[model samples]
Target: MRFLRRHVDAVYDALTVRRSRFVRVEELVIRAAGVVPGLVPTPQEIAAEDGSIQRDKSGLEIDQGLFLSAVLGSERCGRHLCHAMLLPRPEAQALLAQFERDGRVKLDGASVHRAGKAAVVTQDNPRFLNAEDQTSLDGAEICVDLALLDPTTEIAVMRGAVVEHPKYKGRRVFGAGINLTHLYHGRIPFVWYLQRDLGYVNKIYRGLAFADDAPPDEFGGNTIEKPWIAAVEAFAIGGHCQVLLVMDYVLAERSAFLTLPARKEGIIPGAANMRMPRFTGDRIARQAVQYERRLDCDSPEGRLICDEIVETGEMDAAIERVVKGLTNSGVVSAAGNRRAFRIAQEPLDMFRAYFAVYAREQAYCHFSPALIANLERYWNAQSRKP
Candidate 1:
């Protein structure tokens, strides 16, 4: 671990200092690959294999994966990477200025509208039922950053915009998870999973790390943060369900359901394995993540994770009432209380340890033959158009 940490630190510092910006996991991996050949597949090989690089063919890749996992597992390096990712994104300052002036910022795939004391982030991939893809990710993260940084906003609300899909036209869908079509079509990269979990999703959970020199609240440093609320209309599936786990309050329409079908997808469901057990016990979490257990929003099991379930048309009113209630008394201590609860439940060290295992294992899963087979078998992925 110490050896791996030294290498990680050297490469991390070189990339960030030379580039004058924080390094993303993919960029770090690319730099590390120059030092260690065969650590990752070449573009030509990836194109030949359509992103599913067979793991058993290379001992170098396996050993390198384990080495990277150890580096992430180490407390010092893991915390360093986590803190770096939480720093405000490079585009954030410009986006925040626009948001402040117009009270909104609309991007290609998502948008943020300042509504009263809440910043509402609407996922807008309507044709795909608001599924997240490479196109939507950056926009979503920028929106989230503006929401948390806005001084006038006391809380954040996340929901999906109305859709263009035939079956669900004119109706809002919470999200369909990762764009499986893109995954099957080789558009979703391996590091994308890591970037999502460690970047914006973690920001939603832990808030923004404002200073490069200081740590997050869990590490005894200050952060600019606000409570987040999730509104689920149709359903929250796969990665979308993972998002609900980190939300402070979840409001779902009575007909909505939640699911984490990682088994069918043949990938880790982000941090769902580590966090869902807190909401649903070990047995249920296992059943959901491994066996595709669906929980209806109004059901007893679903109510454990969902704070409130409202009738279809009642959602707008419910959101208004909840936002007002959360801020009516002033959210002076919201950030502190949230940090206190997180430190007690999922301190940064625990998350680091879990990701150590996830980092290596999910890499294998992403490039595995099984992933392709599972997508075709369960999702009919081969027939879907990207």
Candidate 2:
């Protein structure tokens, strides 16, 4: 509540102008994120004791909370969707800086390809079916950064790499979720969760792309404020499924399914706890998250999460068609209307309220003894080393 008061006036001032609300909101976010350096640990700082990774933190820093409070608590921005609260200057610049560093580091797990106005960002870690490790997550972060910065990109597409395995043959995998092997050994860092929220997922939902660029209305820039389409080939599990909730459209293969194994893993599945209810309503979202129900893309509940399901090997055609159709109308108007719908469907306060519960509960989930027990029984992390 105190945080709300400190930032409310600034939010009001920004929204008073026509299309400048996003700029104002972003500046606020950048300032907030910048000040929390000590609170925000890097991967190394919070890795588990065994030199691997596991969920283990009752977080003290509230980066998400501070930013959301300002945006949602302010009567003006809350009512207006803060002009889509698109990428702020600091967040975009941070990703840009990381991109420079990433090329030299060469994670090589993610890439962005631009063809004309359409761009595709792919996860390429084929060995683990594109499961997120520190490096792949870093790749995902930079890919979104590039897509957000590229002014030519109209409709951004996110997909995964295909690999030939002795076991699976020629199948392409979208994402296998988190790298549980790392989790079992306690190598996964707490910072991964923070970045997932503030970096990529927030960037996608808020429509932020280029830092400190002219508003899309003034310069006709591509802010990723337009639309995002996700193509899921095999399965989206746990954190991967959480990611789908943020996408504007989800396209999956006929056999693809989504699941949140967070209950079994004993960790919160990113923002799924909050966003899932918006799509599947309260009862259904609870069943999936709490009971570990698998949602097939073709099922009624799955269709709610995935906008469309295509036959195997036909995802490419479907993506092209959707991108062409969405872009044919010109993205400027679409961006504006998206903001309007966002304000109506999800006010900032609602999301802000959710984080209050999430931040506290997730910390407990991270340190739970049950997490290790479940991994041993279900994943056999002790023997299989996965």
Q: On a 0 to 1 TM-score scale, where does candidate 2 land against the true structure?
A: 0.74
- Tens digits of lDDT, candidate 1, 1-386: 45565576565455456334555665566666665565455444445655442332332334445555765776666677777778788787778888898999998778999999999999999988999988899888888888998888999999999999998899999999999998877777666777788888999999998564556855457788899999999999999999999999999999999999999998999999999999999999999999999999999999999999999989889999999999999999998899998898897788878888998898788767888899989988888888
Q: lDDT per model, in order? A: 0.83, 0.66
- In model 2, pairs of residues that clash are 52-186, 52-187, 53-186, 53-187, 53-188, 54-186, 86-208, 87-208
| Clash counts for the predictions, in order | 0, 8
Clashes of 1: 0
The C-alpha stretches of model 2 lying farther than 4 A from their native spots are 1-107, 164-169, 209-224, 384-386
Cα misplacement distance, residue 35 of candidate 1 (Å): 4.7
Worst window of 10 by summed lDDT in candidate 2: 39-48
